[model samples]
Target: MDIGVGFEITYAARRAQRLSNVVLAKARTHTAESIDCER
Candidate 1:
């Protein structure tokens, strides 16, 4: 039971990391586009 709970927590952390990475990528892309537009 403890192992299962630990696995669940690790899985959740990995998923959250992936989500944050995606959000960072999107924000970077948006910033680049805005800068290009300004030029």
Candidate 2:
């Protein structure tokens, strides 16, 4: 039971990391576009 719980926690953490990475990438793209528009 303890091992199963540990696996679940790790899985959740990995998922959260991937989600944050995707969000960061999108934010970076948006910022670049905004800067270009301002110029």
Candidate 3:
């Protein structure tokens, strides 16, 4: 039971990490575009 719980926690952490990375990438792209537009 403990091992199963550990696996679930790790899986959740991985999913959260992926989601944050995707959001970070999109934010960076948006910032770059806005900066280009300013020029």
Candidate 4:
């Protein structure tokens, strides 16, 4: 039971990491677009 719980936690952490990376990438793209519009 403990092992199963640990596995779930690790999976969740990995998923969260991936989601944050995607969000960061989107934010960067949006920022670049806004900068281009200003010019």
lDDT (C-alpha, whole model) for all candidates: 0.99, 0.99, 0.99, 0.99
| Weakest ten-residue segment in model 4 by summed lDDT | 1-10
Which residue runs of candidate 4 sit more than 4 Å off their true CA positions? none
Candidate 1, residue 37: how far the Cα is off, in Å? 0.5
Candidate 3, residues 1-39, lDDT tens digits: the string is: 599999999999999999999999999999999999999
Q: How far is each candidate from the true structure, as Cα RMSD in Å?
A: 1.1, 1.1, 1.1, 1.1
**Winner by TM-score:** 1
lDDT for residue 30 in candidate 4, whole number 0-100: 100
Using TM-score as the yardstick, the better of models 1 and 3 is 1
- Root-mean-square deviation of candidate 4: 1.1
Candidate 1 TM-score, C-alpha based: 0.95
Clashing pairs in 1: none
User: Candidate 2 lDDT, tens digit per residue, 1-39?
Assistant: 599999999999999999999999999999999999999
Between candidates 2 and 4, which one is better according to TM-score? 4
TM-score of each: 0.95, 0.91, 0.92, 0.93
Residues 1-39 of candidate 1 have per-residue lDDT tens digits of 599999999999999999999999999999999999999
Q: Please count the clashing residue pairs in each candidate, in the order shown.
A: 0, 0, 0, 0
Inter-residue clash pairs, candidate 4: none
